[model samples]
Every structure is written in C-alpha cells, then in structure tokens.
Target chain A: MRVRTESILPYSLLAPTLIFITLLIVVPIFQAFLLAFQTADGEFTLTQFEKMIADTSFADALKFTFLLLIFIVPAQVVLALVMALLIHTRFKGHTFFLYIYALPLAISDLAAGIVWLAIFTERGFLNSGLFQLGLLERPFLFLSYQNLPALFSTLIIAESWRATAIVMVILLAGLQVIPRDYFEAADVFGANTLKRTLFVVLPLLRPSLQNALIIRTIFAFQTFAVVLALAGRVIPVLTGEAYNWYALNRNANIAAAYSTLVLIFTVIATVVYFRLLRTSTAEAGFD
Target chain B: MAGIQFQSIRKIFGKTLAANDVSLEIKDGEFMVLLGPSGCGKTTLLRCLAGLERVDGGRVLIGARDVTELAPRDRKIAMVFQSYAVFPHLTVFDNIAFGLQMQSRPRDEIKRRVEDGARLLELSDYLARYPAQLSGGQRQRVAVARAIVMQAAVLLMDEPLSNLDALLRLQMRAELKRLHQEIKATTIYVTHDQVEALSLGDRIAVMQNGRIVQCDAPMNIYDYPANKFVGGFIGTPPMNFLPGVVRVNEGKPIAAVGESHIAPSVALASALIEKNGQPILLGIRPENLALASAQHANTIRARVLVVEPLGSHKLLTVQVGAEISKVSVAPDQRVAPNDDVWLHFDPEKIRWMDAATGDAIHPG
Candidate 1:
C-alpha cells in the first residue's frame, strides 16, 4: 500500500500545474482557434481568415511588425549584453547602476511609450533642446507621416529602452554562474580583455542569449501598446489590428485570426531560435 | 627561463591586508612552493606575481623587467588554478592553443606546440575531447597543458592538485615533479598541504597571517622550523608543544616540562643558559619521540590515553600531566589505550621556543 501511494505521489503533486495550464493556456488557445475557424451561426469555415487576409491593413500590419522586430530585437540584445557585462564587472557603486538599469523594468509599456513620446513630440524636450542649441531653426516636426524613418526609429528606441532591461537581468543571472577562476586563468594565459570576452564569456553565455532571444522575439511580435501610445494610427501592428477588429469593428472572428497569426509567427520565431542557438552538452561541455 | 623576484610586495583587499610586505626571490628554473593555511595570502601573493592582483606597494621584477604595473597578459607567466579552469566550450586541443592563437602565432606553430604539450602530459588522445567528457585528473592535465603550451618562463600553480582524490593527488604530484625536471621552468606553487610542499619544492616558504614565517629547503624546514607555527603546521599529527622553563643544572641547561627535566643540545643549552629560569616551549616532533624502557635518561613517564595502529607505525597519544603528546611507535610494539609508558626525547632534537614570541631560540 505504501509503495503504491509513493508511485501515485509524483502525479498528485503535478496535478495542480497540469490543471492550471489546461484551463488557462490550453482552453483559451482552443477557444481562440474555434473562434478563428467558426462562422457566426456556428458552421465551420475559413471565411474569417480569408477576410482577415483580404483586409488592406493585414499586409501593412505584418510588414510593420517585422520591421519593429528587426530593429528592436537586435538593438535590445546588444544593449542588454553591454549592460549585463558592465554589471558583471562589479565596479564600485555598480549596485546603483543595476538599480538604475532595472528602473525601466518597473515601467509599463504604455508609460514607456508616453515617456518617449514626450521627447519625440514637436514641442517636446528633443526639439526644444535642438532649437535652444540652434541645431534646429524651430521645433521641427519629429513624429509625422512625412518622416517614416524618424517614426520607426522613435518606436525602436522606445521599445528597446523599455524591454532591454528584461534581457539584461537574464544575462546578468547567467554571468553570475560563471566561475571567477576561468577569467583568472585566462588572464594568466595572456588572454586580453576582448579575447577573454569572445572566447570565454560569450560562449558560456549562449544558453541565456537563446532564452532572451526567444522571449524578447515573442514579445516583439505582439508589440501593441507602445505603438498605440506613440505612433497612434500611423503604425499598423498585428495586435493593434486585432484590437481594432475586436473593439471598434466588433469582428471577433477576424480579431481571433489576427491573434492566431501573431501566435503562429511567435511559434516560428521560437523554432528558429531553438534551432539556431541550440547548445548540446557535447558542444557546451557542461550538463 | 627567467627568475622572479617579489620585493616587499603588499596587497590589501577592501578592509583586510591580504599580502603584507612579502619579499622573496626565486632563482631561474627553481621550484618554489608557498605553503600556508587558508586565507594566509599564499594565493594572493602568487596572483600579484601573475599581475592578477595589483600590489599596493613595492615592485615586482621578472628577469630584471619591472612588471609592477603591467597587466597579467603582459607578465609572460602562466598559472594553473585550483579548479583547473579549462574552457568547457573548447576541446582540449583548442584550450591549449588559445594562448598561442591570442599571441597571433602561426597556426602550424600553435598546433605543433599544443600537440607536444599534450603528448608530454599524456593527453594526446584526449585533445579532441571537451573538459566535461574527461575525468577530474584528465581535466586538470588539460589545464596544465594549457599553461605549459605557452612555454612561458614562469609557471604559477595555486593548489593545482588540491581538488583530486588522495591517491590521484599523490600520482599527480609525482607527475608535476617529473614535468618540472623536464622543462625546468621557474615555477611557484602554492598549497596548504605540507607534504606537497615538502616533496615538490626546492625551497618552501611557509606563510602565516599574510606573511612568510619561514623559507628553507624541504628537509631543513622539516628538521628545523623557525617558529612554533612552522613547527606545528609542517608535520602530520603536528609537533607537540609543551610549556616549560629553562633551568641551569650542573652547569648545563635543562628544560623542565611538566615535572620532567630533559637535557638540551650543547648549542641549545648555551642559548638557554642566558635565559635561565625563563618560560619556554619545548617543540617535539612525533617521529622524534621514541618509546623507552623504564628509567631512561631524558625520559618522561606517561599513561597511554589512546593508541592508533597504522600499518608501519602506531600513533600513541600519551598523557604527560595536563598535556597529551603524540608518539609514533613501531607497529609491533606492545601498546594499547590505558597502558603506562615511558617516552624519551633526544637532546639534539629538542628545540626551544620563546614562550611569549613563539620564535625558535637559536644558539649564538
């Protein structure tokens, strides 16, 4: 009886997590798929997806989403890696820098977008400063449809600033697990700072980079609030279109189709990252 | 190969002085071992030589070049760390070649040198394997190969064999000595294991409280420790210290330790006569303490408290007044716990330490 109970114990312990995932994630996703596939009178059809694809904003939304990802993901990763390296160096008062870098993490995406919006606004600090410094003749228009580069750059900068802290925190945790002796040994072996970072630090940090890339790419795919707050109707993203279809147009099926598209892209990106950044124990030489 | 010199080197951590005014000189191709307990700053001193830790004051010279402000990469020295520190991402071959590649040596040269080092360390077959795939000793050999492949004039090892099992440590110790003989690189090895220091070092520097207490050849250090700390630290089962007073008896000096009056050497007697009746410590090595028959000269009667029978020799913990002294006896000797025994000390082997200072009292 005791042996039987022990055999059943692990499954019982795992019961809550399985139930929670099924109800929260699996059930919602299934409902979303049902909504995306079904017609208004409950007949199964592909009309909703066809309608979403035919919508003029669909291609524009896809392009904008990819554009934001191309700009933001790499920028955030590079910036976060530099920040994590600085924190890992542990200079005096570095704890303060950690708090300062993570300060953006506490901000919501809407708030971060609004914060950057103030700078990009025509009469905002950036324009005012440029005007005061005689770099600009007046408060020039910085966030307008006439300047697509400026608009995309503003969104990229804002999203990178807001989300890079997440990647930095993950990278910092990874850096902490590396043994100090490796660096000391490198030093003794005549490895300069750059070589040490390239050979030792970066190679060991692969797993963390993989995780950060996958998570940040998924988040970048679904970027909505920041674009909504900053670009307003100018930038069309997948989530922005989904929100429009659900709330303003009152088209739940199309909204679900847009969301399903985002999920599909996210899965594709995750698969790419898994294949590209995969570290087998044989390669990494660590369990 | 270049000799290394540390001239009054000092290193201080945030609040603690890790290496306090340490000064030493190593001859070219000599194997110097720094032996100390934990936090004694042996590792810190080695790091200062490697330029891993900046000295707070004084100068460091490697073959007449003042390398005080130079970075570790500029120091032209290699070190094997206690944890091995082999790059897990690289195969053993690449790990050994990393330094040569960093120096921008020709690829063929790097390959040849790495292969030679791998062969020397008996790791030629394991070159293509990663660190995790190898056993602990093999991984450590990879680390050693990484250092030796550099062909640097100086090699520093900070407790390299400390991570291995006892038998493996012994095996590696012999291998390290053999490697040193073949290469004859000026090596500075740091460890807390006295046996490692005794067996490997041409000269052993024993450190305490972030300062070197004594530096001498292996046998000299074992036979004549400079202070109570060195004496106590350098031996297994430790040297027994008994507080006593120096007394002049029949124009010769004697040490009274716990109701037993033992004669001192002629040189030691002359030294103690000047400080007659002064309190002193009697330092006796366990191996030097012999079991005696009843009523022997310079003998103290003791009751055996515990007897540990080793294979060749037995360790007898015998009580002499309030102090218990360990005596190594022949294994065939009849002794057991609670047995009464007489222990004798050789006059020439007795060392007198100043009770207050713990420094050995040498004859004039």
Candidate 2:
C-alpha cells in the first residue's frame, strides 16, 4: 500500500507523452470516425458511405494506391538492400555513399515529389537531356495524362528513390551491428558469398528487416504528396482523393469516409507484414 | 591431415607491417601455437594461413596443394573464432551442421557428423538450445563443435578461450587439448596467454614485431628463448639476467658482476673461457637462485625488498647491486624486507646470452 517517490517518478515523466497522445492522436481518430458516420444535421447516416462507393474516381483511387504499393514497395526493399550491402562493404568511399543514400531521408515526401517532377515533367531536364544526347529526337511528354504507364512508372521511380533510403538506413544499422566474426566463420567453413548472406546475414538481420518492411508498408498505403505533385488529377490516389473531397468540393463527410478506407487498408497491410515477417523473441536480438 | 607452410608471407596494413616476411612450417597433426602480445601479427599470420587476408608477398601451401589463391572453403580448412560467432537465430544443431549443409552433404550424414561432434564436445544435450540461451563456455563448445564437425584437414583457432572467464578458460583449454588428441587435425591456435601456449602447443612460435622470434618445443622455448623479448614474454616471474664480464680469476673462468666474481655454469664456463674480458648476460630462472647461510665463493650479497608469501612458496624481491631480481624460495624460509642475504645460483640451470644482441650464446 506504500507508494515510493522513485517508483512514481518514471510515470510522472511519461505523463506528458501519454496526455499528448490521447489528445492529439487518439481523439482525432475518434473524431474522424464520428465525422465519417454522421450527417451535417447530426443524424447517424450511411449517406456518406454510399457516395464514397458510387464516386467513379473512388475506384481509380483504390486501384492507383494498390498499384503503387505493388510496384514501389518491393522495388524499394530490393534497392535498399543492395545499397545497404554496398555501403556495408566499406570499399573506399563507403562513407560518401552512406551520406548520399541517407540524404533523401532528410527531405520531406512533398519536396521529393517536386524534385522528381522537375526531372520527369514535359520539357523537363530528363527530356531536354535526352534530346541533347540524340537519344530522343524531340522532347517527350512522359508524364502527360495520355501516357498512363509512363506516368505510373515515373511516379514509381520518384517514390522508390525517396523512400528506399529509410529501409537502407535501417538495414545498414543492422548490417553494422552484425559482428565481422560471423562472416569470417562462414568463410572459414567454405560458404560462398550468396550462402553467407542467406544463412548468416539475412537470418541475423530479421528483426531490422521486419521493422523496415512494416514501416515502409504503412507509408506506402498512405502515399499522397508525390503522386499529387507529379500527375496532379491524372493519378487518382486514395489520399489525393480524400484531400480533393475535403478541400475542393468542401465535403468533409466523404473525405473522412475516404480516410477511413485508407486507415483500414493500412492497418490490414501492417498486420499482414507483422504476420509474414514475424521474429521470435530469441531471434529478435543477440544479447 | 594436412601440413601447412607459410613461405615468407608479408602482409602490410596501411603503414604498419602486420606480417613481415613470416615463414613457418607446421607439420601435419601438430598443434602449433602462435603466441605473442597484442598487435604482434600472430592473428594476422593465422589469417593469412586461413586465406582470409591476401598476402602481399610469398605463397601458402596446405598438404601438397598451393592454397594461396584458394578460398577458405576450397582450402579445406575450418576455424573457431574468438567470438564463437554461432548463428544467434539458429539452434545448436543447425549451427553445427551449417558448413556440411553448405557443402551439400546428405541429410543423414550431416546429422551423424553433427551428433558425433556434439558428443565429442559434450554439447549433445544443448543441441536444441539457441546460442543466446547458453552460457559463454557452452557457446565456445558450439564454435569448437562447428569447426571440428567439418572434418577438414586443417583447423585454425583465434584465441577461442579468450572471451571466457578465468575458470571457464582453464576448463575450455583442457577440452580443446582433449579434442585435438581425439581428432589429430593440423591446428594453428593463436593466443597471447603463455600458459595456454605452454600447456597446449606441440610447438610454440613466439612472435614479436610481425616476425617469429623463436619456434621450438614449449619447454625449449621456455628454457632457451631466442632473444630478450621471448625471455621476458614467457614465464611467470620471468628469467633474471645479470650483467657481467667474463674474467679469469686465479685460473678459474668467472663472471665479474661489478666487484664480485660469481662462478659460471660448466657449459657457460666453457663458452666464456675463450672470450675473456667480454661482456655477457647470465640468464637464470627465479627458482634456480637459493639463499646461502654464509658468504661463499659463488654467492652474491642481495638486499631483500619485499617478501610475498604465495601459498606453497615465497617470492622474494631482492636487489643485487644495480640489478633488481625475484627469487622464489620455500614458504618456511624466514626472510623479510631489508634483510641482507647471500644468494647462490645453480650452475647447471644457468643460461648464457650475448649482452648486446640478447641471442643465446650456445656452448661449443
């Protein structure tokens, strides 16, 4: 029944974060749920849900978001792993490469979108450089509304370039902590590079891999700024659609409904990631 | 089994010479210990033999095959690292069987070999446990088991017991020696601990400054070190060196330390008579020096500084003129600080060395 000051001190220290999270994060989620379900007259209604289902761009938004996830996430994972390994080799200018790779992590998603937009836009640097090099006879409209595939590919490249660094940074940290002795031991036992990576490095890096995968997958489902910057209204992503519904059309109800859908998708994707990349408590660390 | 030969291998790291033209030949089935202090290139030389590091010069051979260009696996070798490096995620069974699996051995054969290795290292019960679940000694056994399970012609160990506690290090040292006996694989064990080298090595190669100073049987290396560094590096209290000049007193060849004439051993006496009036070093072990009841012909007066009672025996720190030396005596001997005593040297146990070069001056 006795409470000590030392025991209560840690809880007091954590009180601010707990209070802020409830007010800023938990309260808003509930607020979003209420706005999504209720009407302007304050009556419980399925009208917002009906409109969300019927809107033609709603299907396109879902398709575009899932398309981006399918192409972008795996590509980012592979590219990041290769980049991390290259840096891990510590050959000559590895520190320089690490700095360059992690440079994108400091840039916001919107800034990254605008930077890539400059490259892939019609008459942009990409087209001008290609034309100058004689690779293209004239400037190409790569991200035009007509060229859906090219637009999608450019968007994929931009997103992958911007996001892959996060995974690489995580994996590089993991790689650095893996003791050099493991690789040497594998070498002494006659394992080739591929076998060593698979049997030793990959297994030891499981916890970091799971972390990077879960974090990237959640961000993939909620991708918004880069798509809006590159293709504008041409690419109908779910988050872009939500923003348009709320800002341009002034319909907070339908926007909240769209947000709810994105929330559902991200939660499901995050759960799937957790299930797939599960690490046992023992495998999670080596202390 | 495979004999290893390092043909004047040179490994330079940045500006430092890690292995400077180091050449050593290890006979098949011999447990060779590369013993040295840190940064002495003992580990570097072993790594060169393992093909972990490319030699900037010379060649390496295992058995009859030139393995300098071969990969570690292709060289047919196994190594136990100082950190154990057992796969943290895998069970003991999987970690032991990893090399065999990489070589694509049959499932049953891999299982059998792993089981045999576990039995040998007494890790049969811990096969189901992960490395993180085991103690430090257990993890070391896992590393050893993994290495021996390969049945390679050559085995290399880099201070495998260095990470364990003192008691565990002693226990693991015995286990390694026992395992080497059961499987007579050519092993190159690297350690800075002289006790490990003396107890486990068939031959000890004492290294310093990236070169092998002496390579001989453990006792020989202890009794007759190649140089002062080797003499100082080995032994607990170490060999005591007395600076003196060879002189003929009345017809007897004796070594004059300052104003006192101490008789040299029979072998050292013969080696000294030819070169009279030449400076030489008399290297004698601490246990070889005893206290004399009175001043005798071969006795030197020493002032005791500290008398430390070490269980079964007593170690006396005594100053003989300009030289400070340790003398081990029986526990019952009555000696104290500031006690002046006459010390006697057993002539048969004395070793003579060149004062300038510090090399052994062998009897002709």
- Report the number of the highest-lDDT candidate: 1
Q: Number of clashes in model 1? A: 0
Give the per-residue lDDT digits (tens) of candidate 1, residues A184-233: 87777777888888888898888899999999999999898889988987
What does candidate 2's lDDT look like per residue over A19-45, in tens digits?
Answer: 999999999888888889998878898
lDDT for model 1: 0.91
Q: Candidate 1: give the TM-score of chain A.
A: 0.92
Q: Write the per-residue lDDT of candidate 1 for residues B322-364, one digit (tens) a residue.
A: 8889999899988878877788998788778999999999996
Q: What residue runs in model 2 are displaced by over 4 Å at the alpha carbon?
A: A1-51, A128-141, A282-287, B250-252, B273-279, B334-338
The reply for model 1, stretches above 4 Å from the true place, is: A1-24, A284-287
- Candidate 1 CAPRI level: medium
Q: To one decimal, what is the Cα RMSD in angstroms of model 2 from the true structure?
A: 3.3
